[model samples]
Target: MIEILNPTLLTRAAGTGALVADILHTLKGRSTAGTNLLDIDRWAKAMITEAGALSCYVDYAPSFGRGPFGHYICTAVNDAVLHGRPRDYALADGDLLTLDLAVSKGGVAADAAVSFLVGDGEHPESVAMINATERALAAGIAAAKPGARIGDLSHAIGTVLSEAGYAVNTQFGGHGIGSTMHQDPHVANTGRPGRGYELRPGLLLALEPWVMADTAELVTDADGWTLRSATGCRTAHSEHTIAITADGADILTLPKHMRP
Candidate 1:
């Protein structure tokens, strides 16, 4: 479903976006070398409850995943990339961790994700992969405008990933989000420009650019939710929820501490 948020609802969306961003930032800060993925999930639940927000994931049952995600946040580590279900694994030094989160406040929802290293180990390959995704995400956001097409954003993101020498996977990518975690107008990481839906004011999009170091293929783990690189290569993901406006795009999911 493609939703164009009214002004009031857009305001609510900004709040939800801030909440999701703050939660992810907090979780990333708390995720140390010995922190367990399950503990991170518990922390997310507590924070969401305290903020009086509803989780868009915990009870989520989608076609690609098993019923009832049963986790407050996605804890993708190293080789894992998307829809990573929180489990009993403890984080290790230099483990590339991706935390994806979505939540609703005041009836509007926002989604975002961030990838970062777990501890004080400087894994050059992991750092480079994470940086590439971040750059791709920035390019995608910069390409968003009122008159732009979805393909423009995708192309911008894809360009960055391809130039960084990483393979792109289109099976699951960014999508329209508004009152729900995932919605219409599937935004692939790569696409031709001047194609797909045209942007309009009030439209909300979650632009995510993710990539695997070596291959574009994905393999689901035994948990039935976590998606890992088919070649066991490390992966990275970056995302932000933005609202289309007359001037340009308003990135709503930046953490309070990160806002200018």
Candidate 2:
């Protein structure tokens, strides 16, 4: 379902987006060598509860996943990329970690993700992968404007990834998000430009660009939720939720402290 939020609803969406961003920022700060994945989930749950918001992950049971997600945040480390379910694992130095989060507040939902290195170390490949996703996400956002087609955004994103020498995966990508966590108007990471649904004011989209180091293929872990690279190469993912507006796309998931 494609959802357009009114001014008031857009304000609420901003609030939810900020909340999601803040939580992710906090989680990233807390994640370090020896940090347990479960601890990150606990921190997210507490923050969400304290903000009087609802988690879009817990109790989430989708066909692509096992039963309920049963986690507050997605902690994807190293080889793990999408739908990473928190487990009894501790982070290690130089481990690439991706934190994806979505939450609802005041009846609106916002989703975002960030990938970073856990500890101080020079993992050039991992750093490059993370930077690629971030750049692709920025490119996608730049292509989002009123009257712009979804394909334009996808193409912009794909261009960045492909130029960086990373293979694009279409199995899972961004999507429309509103009152619910996931919605219609699927946004692939790669697509032809000048196609797909045209953008309009008030439309909300979560554009995520993710890639594996060596392969586009993915393998589901035994947990049934964590998706890893087929070649066990490091991966990275970056995402942001933006609201379509007259001027352009307004990034909703940017934390207040980081905003100018």
Candidate 3:
């Protein structure tokens, strides 16, 4: 379903978005060498509960996944990318970690993700991949505005990834998000400009740009949730929840201090 949030709902969305961003920022700070993935999940749960918010992922059961997600957040490390289910594993130095989070508060939901290296390990390739995704995400956000087509954002995102020499994977990409976590219209990572759904004020979209180092193919882990690169190459993902407005696209998922 596509939801055009009203003014009040948009205010609530900003609150939820800030919470999601703050939680991610805290988690990223806590994640380091020897940190267990399950601990990160626990931290997320505590923060969400303290904020009186609901986790969109815990009860998320879709055809693609094994069952209810049963987790507070997604912890993707190294080769793992999307739908990364927290497991019993300690992170190592230089491990690329991607934390994707979605939460609802005051009847509105916001989603975002960030990929960064853990500890003091210099992995140039991993650093480059993370930077590329961040740049692509910025490009996608820049292309979003009232009257802009979804394809414009996708094309902008794809252009960055392609120029960075990374293969684009469309199997899973950004989507409309509002009261619920995932909604329509589906925003692919790559598409032709001037095509697809046209943007309008009050529309909320989660624009994510992710890429694997070598190939576009993905393999599901035995856990039936975590998606990894087929070539086991490092990957990165960046995302933000944006609200379409008269002036332009307002990024809802930036930290409170970072917001204007």
TM per candidate comes to 0.99, 0.99, 0.99
Q: Assess candidate 2 and give its TM-score to the true structure.
A: 0.99
lDDT of 3 by residue, 155-183 (tens): 99999999999989999999999988999
Off by over 4 Å in 3: none
lDDT, candidate 1, 32-142, per-residue tens: 999999999999999999999999988899988877898889999999999999998999998999999999899889999999998899899989988999999999989
Cα lDDT of all candidates, in order?
0.93, 0.95, 0.95
Q: Per-residue CA lDDT of candidate 2, range 78-110, in tens?
A: 999999999999999999999999999999999
Stretch of 10 with least lDDT, candidate 3: 251-260
What's the true lDDT of residue 145 in model 2? 98
How does residue 78 of candidate 3 score in lDDT?
92
